[model samples]
Target: MFFIYSFTADTPPNICITGPYKTWRAVIPADTHSLSPVLYCSGCEDHVSVSADQPNSQMETDEPQSFFAAFCQLLFKSVRYICIYIIEFFTGPKQSLKGNHSDNKVNLVLLGMSGTGKSASGNTILGRRQFVSRTSSVPVTTECQVEETEINGTCVCVIDTPDIFDDEIESSVKNQHVTKCKQLLQSGPCVFLLVIQVSRFTDLERDILRKLEKAFGSKAKEQTVILFTRGEDLQCADMNLEDFLQDCNSDLKNIVDQCGRRCVVFENKTSHKHQVTKLMQKVDEMLNKQQNQ
Candidate 1:
């Protein structure tokens, strides 16, 4: 006599049957071996059976298989990232994935009254005539313009603006010019070049610093550098920058003092590269000091 039964254990139970000319054997299916189902003889009255509450062995193994698959996937991702980093180290990235180098540039904003040589000074700093600069009864730079150049490996952005401090210019127009200048400031430290002609401080320029503060906030003075244009005027007068500043009007001296006494004399008519170099050195020093603070 034989009977079929299914067990959930890993191994089949051993059964012993003793009767007159009767014996029983156990068998397991090949296809359902993982389930560990067992067959027993019907004559075996005493034997262990699987309970309904017991879980199958096949179901238990599924969790391990899932975990192994997840582990393999994680290992593959790790290898891929390593390969990418190695490739980049060897061949370098095709482009800047984060941002461009222009974000690290320093902006040099030219601010002064009309006929103060702002446009000419901008051209001198850039070492090119990017702005229309010429002697005229009216403002030569009627709008704001931007140009870029490199000074001693440092990227420099020069911004030339119209005479926003002019009394004749409408307040709305002045505000618009100021707004445009602020927009072009972009992302970087800004240094304002308060251009003033040598020995030419007029009534219009007396309160120029106050107007600058009104346009760009009071902190503007902290980063301002008084740029005296037409160094030839000082040379013709047989005086150096120090002498000129010493004899300058009280209001002009006060403005320079308010700007931390940062000043540079530029002979825009001459091709003296050292002048630009010296100015850039001062700018670097200012930037370094700002960083330290």
Candidate 2:
């Protein structure tokens, strides 16, 4: 007597089956079945009876076939790896706005009152018009904005934020802006650019450093760089950066001193690259000092 065992795609409904085993049939003679009347499924411990006379007798095979089992196992592994690759291709690695501090990326957050040319300064640093900059009586940037660029092979991320220190703005809204800026930092090293006009310091900006500390915590002043915009006004007065700072009022001078005397002047109207270069140098030096401490 002869007995035939068949396997189908849906026959072995078990999790142990790893591959598509469809229409696989094997023949066994009843005389041979007396020694081993049962055969186990490939990659599965479940056994099937192939008895002619008793039809319910189950036994295990001493040795199974090699080539067919090896093929199924190899196919399953190949399919699994292909799926993993496809998933990784669609959802790539995660990256922050400026990347981590270990990557040597610079994150510059521009903070100041309105009409201080903060957006213009951001455009100048990126060498492009990334943020909207125009003269207006009210604030132009109403939300936190970010732009990134590569400077001398160093990655730089510039975050332009609205005037959160304004009394008219709601505290909730101001908190939202601060929260967004912190999220962008991604726990990396950051330098705040406290933008101030060259010749247009107002009473509103007198206690700006204190406001910055309140918003960004105590370490704000230590990691800050005084960015003075509208350098053309200084040029028209025939005054250089050092001369202007020397003649500045005691209040402004004190603010600059508290920021470790780190400052840079930018003439946004001009296309000069030296001013941006100077600002990046100041930022790099401040970051290095912070790292050392």
For candidate 1, write residues 183-245 as lDDT tens digits.
988577899999999868898888998899999998888888889999999999899999999
lDDT of 2: 0.73
Q: Clashing residue pairs in candidate 1, if any? A: none
What's the residue-level lDDT of 162 in candidate 2? 94
Model 2, position 115: C-alpha lDDT score: 91
How do all models score by TM-score?
A: 0.65, 0.65
Query: What Cα-based lDDT does every candidate model obtain?
Result: 0.71, 0.73
Name the lDDT value of residue 230 in candidate 2.
91
Candidate 2, residue 104: Cα displacement in angstroms equals: 1.6
> How big is the RMSD of model 1?
19.0
lDDT of 2 by residue, 96-187 (tens): 33222245577899999899999999999999998999989888999898899888777788999999878778999999999998888733
